[model samples]
Target: MFEPEKMKSKGLKLERMANRLSNAIEKANHNYEIEFEAANKYL
Candidate 1:
């Protein structure tokens, strides 16, 4: 799902931006998982 070369060829700034976006997405996924776990507690 990740294309580092495609990101690199775009631009250094783009590459960094992509990396930051990936981190943000991962954080979001973690938050979602935690929320799901909390919700499941009463289920």
Candidate 2:
């Protein structure tokens, strides 16, 4: 017997996970471009 409250909690957790993933990708993209550009000056 599944309950509605449990389902809502699971949905909330999934939403948080999605948000974290989005933030991580944005951060990686920003850092990668910045770092590469900076490194190019030395090479």
Candidate 3:
């Protein structure tokens, strides 16, 4: 027996997790870019 409400909640939970992972990756990449640019100034 499948419950529609449970399915919807599970989908939403997965979506939220995916979004958080992507945001974290973007923040890490942004920080890396900033550090790289700053290091370039010394070279």
Q: Per-residue CA lDDT of candidate 2, range 1-43, in tens? A: 9999999999999999999999999998888433466677789
Worst 10 residues of 3 by lDDT: 32-41
Per residue, candidate 1 scores C-alpha lDDT tens digits across 1-43 of: 9799977777888878999999999998888433466677688
What residue pairs clash in candidate 3, if any at all?
none
Candidate RMSDs in Å, in order, are 9.9, 4.8, 4.6
User: With candidate 1 superimposed using the best TM-score fit, by how many Å does residue 29's alpha carbon deviate from the native?
Assistant: 0.2
TM-score of each: 0.48, 0.66, 0.70
Supply the global lDDT for candidate 3.
0.89
Q: Rate residue 12 of model 1 by lDDT.
A: 89
lDDT of 3 at 14: 100
